[model samples]
Target: MRTRTEENPDYCAIESAMEVLGGRWKLAILKQLTPGTLRFGELGRALPAITPRMLTRQLRELETDGLVTRTVYREVPPRVEYTLTDAAHRLDAIMSQLDTWGRWYRDTVRPGDAERVT
Candidate 1:
């Protein structure tokens, strides 16, 4: 249920970003992986709502995009872990900005006349 959108060549940057992180689950995936390497089961437990199949698919895409590194260990039970690569650290600054914007939105834009947390 996806469609290509190169129709507006001028929006290459927007499209490119979307191509990388465009999905309901991608950001949550990145956030969970940001802390450190984790086993598949650990990731699954941390993100209770995400199905194992979907997490596997996202991990594969992130590995292909050079954002995540996957390692497998040879053992009886078998072990697999995923860690964020240096390239993904670039998101730190962007995430900080997003945090600021979120605070601003909650303080100024959100309605219902709720009291500010600050």
Candidate 2:
């Protein structure tokens, strides 16, 4: 299979990266998964705003993109866990930078509402 850069040499890298991480919930999900593996219910509880269907879709997409791994255990009640892959771990630095930029923007550019809340 041709790699993205090989297939579309002219495509902007940022656009390509956004294609994989654009959705509202994907980044949040990735942030939550950064700590360690979590079960379906655990993820759901952690992200109370996400519906079950949306969470499932986001997880499947993340898995397809090789960012996350899902394992199913053989047990009477059944157990499943999701964890970040090595490639996903590489995103930690980027995400942390983004988080810093987000805080800066919130404090410097758009401060009133967030400041009031804090």
Candidate 3:
């Protein structure tokens, strides 16, 4: 994966941030991680659309971003859990704001408003 700086010399902070968490499953993974740590199987069940290989790939990206931590236990069969790092917890506040804004938009906007667009 290319570093954002290498990808864009004049990149703004929000663009850099989006590069980290803007994938199809990234934000959904973050939402699931907020409740607590979860095993690979649990995450798989929570997001039925994602395959095992894809989940592993996305988790690795999140780990690389410093937004998530993966722990392994040396049990009979290796037990592992994924949890959000401190950096990711900061997203909670932002997500909450987005939720509020979404509700407001849904309440105030009509579906036919798109007719005005040309």
Candidate 4:
């Protein structure tokens, strides 16, 4: 994969979006946060397949990309929460459409495969 910089660019918009939204877990994390803010533990439970380290890395990337905002409250033990930025909310419709298309493909194109994967 090529690294993108502000000074030089040569990728399409979709590629740029994928750069931030790439990987299996980013989208799932975003979907979990779509309803509202969630704690680290909650997110971990929601995405049981993701390791804690990988989840932290993805959250950091999302924060760097301006897709997510991480808020840490000053407390005794320490509390941190994540919420979507305006940019991520903008993807709601697109993600919904993709979900619909994915279901259609799984149901019609590969009926047997979906059950095995899930």
lDDT of 3 by residue, 1-95 (tens): 54663465464777777888878888888889998999989999999999999999999999988999999999988899999999999999887
Most TM-score-accurate candidate:
4
* Candidate 3 Cα errors over 4 Å, as ranges: 5-11, 99-118
lDDT tens digits by residue: candidate 2, 11-117: 57775677678889998899899999999999999999999999999999899888999999999799999999999999999988988988877767754456554
The true-versus-predicted C-alpha distance at residue 14 of model 3, in Å, is: 0.9
| Candidates 2 and 3 compared by TM-score, better number | 2
Q: For model 4, how does the per-residue alpha-carbon lDDT over 1-118 read when each residue is reduced to its tens digit?
A: 4356343456556667777888989988998999999999999999999999999999999999899999999998899999999999998998888889888776677655655553
* Best of the two (3, 4) by TM-score: 4
Candidate 1: residue pairs that collide: none
Q: How many angstroms is residue 62 displaced in model 3 relative to the true structure, after the best TM-score fit?
A: 0.3
Candidates arranged by TM-score, highest first: 4, 2, 3, 1
lDDT of 1 at 14: 76
Clashes of 2: 0
Q: Candidate 4, which segments miss by more than 4 Å at Cα?
A: 5-11, 111-118
C-alpha local distance difference test of each model: 0.79, 0.87, 0.86, 0.87
TM per model?
Answer: 0.74, 0.81, 0.79, 0.83
TM-score of model 4 vs. true structure: 0.83
